[model samples]
Target: MSLRKQLNDILPTLLPNNPAEAIKGTELIRLARINLTGNYSDASLRYHFSIMSCDPTSAIAKVEKGQGYYRRSEPLPALSGAQELLAWTQGRLDDISGDDSSVDSAMLRIRKFRAVVTRYYEVNGRFPFAFRDPFTNTSPLGNLWKYPELVLVDWETGGSPDEEMSLDGGMLSLKQRLGIAPFRLHSARLRLSPSLMTYREDFFQTLSVSMWAQGGELIYAGPIADEALADGLRKLSAAYGVGVTSFGMTPEVLDDLPRPANILNAHPKETEAIMAKLDIHKIAAAQSRPHLDWVALNSLRSESEEADKLVAWLNHCIDERRAEPFKDE
Candidate 1:
């Protein structure tokens, strides 16, 4: 049987009294483009499902890969401090330099740097630039350039810092120095209850992996539950089905995470954060207007009224033109 159908059959048995909860959660997962499935716990009788949407090559991956590691398994080269900022700046330098040798050597250097940054904070109990505000280019909360020597090195001459460069002279240099690349790495944290927090992280990661695996672009991430997760997933599923049957999901990954919240919601949230994050506005609209063909037919009446008004205006203009006549020579 189809996964959706199987889910439908199992849902009643899982949550006899709370089928609505299952529906609500499932719907939200679909909308959020997260993938998950779960089994009922005999002890609690509460279907404990996880949200799975984080991508393997997500921002977390970038941080890890930059430091020659994986996920949260190992120490990163930078850990949200001045040293991290330096490393980030240096990464841009390497990108700009286009130094093949440096690129090859960067993984080791990044790992070492991540370790150093962690230790720097261990002794000092503070990060290098906790709030440098990279987007605004202002250190409103923290000064990243605590080390002047590092700053000098960052802003030094615009040449191939370590040669091995080629790509229209200074173009490659400028690109790296300015941190202008096709791929950018970023990370942020959100607040949520322990239960909700776990779900959110799982959902984010699952979505990330699916998107990357399918060569899709990322949008954003956040916690969702109650009616929100339900509504989102339903809309998403309607637009795109679930599991390995879907373009970007694997059965193993899908079965490992949270069940859809839609099955549980009697009335899902009209406004869900996942919809906004994924830019699934169109999908949401379509779901909301399931009878969109009827809407178009109704809208045609308004168009007809407008057309009548235009016809009257055009006739009036023609009459005026006739009255005025051609006075030009």
Candidate 2:
């Protein structure tokens, strides 16, 4: 049997699933040798490990921004990811035909991506408020057009990067005195993949959901590798004023990320390591408006409870003369 075959059979048992607990190549080779045949040298074993880790079906995986190997969990089927997203958006959950394992894996990736985006923006000084209810299983079909998955608030704050900042009092006062809104609201639509077949829906959904906000953005977990897709997104963004960006999360890297809870609660060091894995690319910049569409925003109050909470939260912060990360409670 080939060494790759032997490693394929042997590595799953030796490699840990968690990336943080990945076994270094040196140690993995040592353990793998006990079960590997043909007396492979360390260099040969290392080379095999490197090559095999790149194979999606292989039991082993290399961390994207770190050393060592971990067990690569089985990914959501490549072709089905978009289909699943479609079924989800249409609220036809019954149409998504997958076994429990695959469905759970798909949902986990969606959640981890959300957690990653939330943390990414927060650390970059944008406060993200997720409208979870609109995307939940209980939501009605076509809600994607009616509600954004996230609303990112960019506030003018004065403070060090290491600490949560209070709103810049002078800026706040000036905006209030001038009767201008004190923040930029960029509504965002998050998706696991960016595909030619689905980019239009993604872009239009982002635009529809953010009609009331100052700007809109379509964010994808995976990189935008296809030039035609990039061009298409750029054209739509140019015409419609929506932003398009990717977090550079390939399916493999996404599967290797920590679970949603751990990601959301990541410490500064852990968050830093995770952030290092991102390759943020801006396909197009969102055009901001000088003012929000108040008449359009008023229409949402009849549809989404989240819309009310969003308004109330902003009012609370403005009234208190401070800016802070949101707490659900």
Candidate closest to the true structure, highest lDDT:
2
Local accuracy of candidate 2 as per-residue lDDT tens digits, 116-227: 9999998888999878766655556567687887899988776766534677788899999998899999999888876655678778888988889999999999876544
Native RMSD of candidate 2 (Å) = 9.9
Residue 117 local lDDT, model 1: 25
Worst 10 residues of 2 by lDDT: 75-84
* lDDT of candidates 1 onward, in order: 0.25, 0.79
The residue-by-residue lDDT of candidate 1 on 155-179, one tens digit each, is 1122444431212334435654774
TM-score of each: 0.16, 0.72
What TM-score number comes out for model 2? 0.72
